[model samples]
Target: MSIFKKIKGTFQLLKTIDLDQLAKLNEKIDLSDAIKNLGELDERQLKGLMKMLTTKAKKGQHQLPPIDGDFYNLDLKLSKEDRDIQLQVRNFMEDEVKPLVNDHWNRAKFPFQIIEKFAKLNIAGIAYEGYGCANKSFLLEGIIAQELARVDVSISTFFGVHSGLAMGSIYLCGSEEQKQEWLPAMQRLEKIGAFGLTEPNVGSAVAGGMETTCKRIDGNWILNGQKKWIGNATFADVIIIWARDEDSNQVKGFLVRKENPGFKAEKMEDKMALRIVQNAIITLTNCSVPESDRLQNANSFKDTAKVLQMTRAGVAWQAVGCARGAYEAALKYTKKREQFGRPIASFQLIQNHLVEMVSNLTAMQTLCFRLSELQDQKLLTDEHASLAKVFCSMRTRDVVGRAREVMGGNGILLEYDVARFVADAEAIYSYEGTKEINSLIVGRAITGYSAFVN
Candidate 1:
């Protein structure tokens, strides 16, 4: 072949070749001086070299579509009205709560100033029928929980304790007159509520082990005992205190108002997690609650479980939110933070971490969707709630850990948002039901064996 023809064929082949690979090939071939000389080439030649480098860089670039944790697009399935409500809550959290969370968490104080803004959402007693509730689907309730926890788990816990645990006690076990007395005002958030179930000695085992006692005397029941870890109890207008009836030996719930004598709720201090929740160590010595205020239908522990069963699903959704918050924060950090003149996200190993984190997050979102569906359908058993709680909470810990891992030192900083999730996830893992407790619940259901307390 002629020399000119041979050179023309070589240039044509090089033009078609992947420039990134060619750049690497050029590097290995010790073309440093030639590459340097090319930099001094004329504008047109320099432009051509720059174009080739850009093409090569683009080829070497990892194509990561925007990471959306909602793999199933469950929001699309919601009705327009429901979707609006969801966005309303989401906006409220993202705008109002997100900015204040780190400060409140660090100070270990509830952002009481936001309560008025929160009341405007009108979501208290959501999904409950009648008595001024929005009567939305249980799905909306789960979505609300997710939105709240996504920004601040402490706020979500406070909401759940009031709306789900306190009001739920009245809704599920209160008589018509009793419900008429409190549900409406509480629904409007004019009167905040708190649930007092966990005593210092009695945790989830309070079903039968409530050391707090109630004795019927004179037209009223006198409650005497200490209730610990009562969220919102410090400022709640009415706290639902569960106690054992001394005579019948059955547990009963009472609507103990804050003004009542002998009822004291001192804020539990120095909490390592969910600090903004305002959990109280309550003491009731001769706290007199009128018979009318007693949750009339709460004859025993079984009645209490009815409330827990409904709220347990919400807790699982909270776990999903906590995981998602951490995951997104970490994913963004990885893309922005650079090492060795490139984004850490450009590293294959970092990407592998992100993929795994998303995998777990997507699994959690999908699982919670079904969980809320089962709840809406009235088919959510203890085992179903337990399964989601176990899986989501456990997986949330993993997700948060990966988030922290990706952030390196910043992961441990409270201002980064991920550290709070990592700390809060620990509390959530134990509360509602510990990993072991929830696992045993599911285990018993599958194996037909009661493994608790034995």
Candidate 2:
């Protein structure tokens, strides 16, 4: 080939690296002087240089088509109305959330601005009647979770804490007065909420090992103890704090308002994943709440279990979204990324990686779809949600690993978007319950052997 075509091919490969890489490359060799040196070369030397630059041994370049997820067309399963809802969320995530995700994640800050825009969707507290909530299906709720998690898991975490954990706690356990007071504003995003069940010493054992104490005093409940890993507690309007009743020794829930003088919430920092979520350590030093604020129907730990059961399905769907985001980003990158004189997607080995990712993503989506069906049918149980959570979270870890592997070095950078998923997957794997806990729940149910305490 002539020098013009040879240089063009060389530059095409060089385009793969950005300005920072170019600056680093300049430290070893000056690009301007090198280009000038090319003109001085003899014909034989130029041909040899061209061979070295383009590696003439490689075959011709070929453009590969773009890769996408949802190979099975799972979206078709939804009704027209639900499909429209999915598109509405997808468009919102792409437009309002996508551009700001990386920046907020990098700064470890939440974009408070999005709350007003998000409230307009009126999706909070779904599946509950009245309270200004949508009262939609769990399937649609799962789809929304997937959409939020696709762009940013931290936002999904925030939403889950508010919509699923906090609001669901009240919906399932609070009285009509409690629901009427909080749900409407919460659904509209005028009031933010947080769920405080996980404590520093009480994580997987939140059901039975809760250390926070609530005591009745002069017609008021005085709460004391600490809660760890409480999402949105730092700025939430209300935090549903779970405490053991000193007199009864049973776990009870309380609607702890944010402004209580005895309540202290310190922001937990230096997180490696889901940095945008403002998790906090909450200390209730004799925090006083009126008797009316106590969850009227949450008489025992069993009530907490009810709220968890209702929300665990959403966690499974969030894992699916996390995996899908990574898969889609990696797939797109591999297709456009030129390697060996052609797109990497053309390579048989690369195709294997891409196929595995989409396969797992599709399988997880289908599983959650059925899981939601069971939930809507009122046939869902602890074991059912536990199974889905274990499978999806574990599979998501695998999918994100493959995604990172396919992107090579670019996979780890936040700018490329796959790294966040890889990190956020850790949080998802441990959210609601860890893989071990969820598996145990399913194991005991199937085998008729209790293993939680032992």
Q: Which numbered prediction scores highest in lDDT against the true structure?
A: 2
TM for candidate 1 is 0.85
Local distance difference test scores for all models: 0.86, 0.89
Evaluate model 1: give its lDDT: 0.86
All candidates: CA RMSD in angstroms?
13.8, 13.5
Candidate 1: residue 436 Cα off by (Å): 1.2
lDDT tens readout by residue for model 1, 223-328: 9999888899889999988999999999999989999999999998898899898989999999999898889999899999999989999999999989988888
Worst 10 residues of 1 by lDDT: 1-10
Off by over 4 Å in 1: 1-64
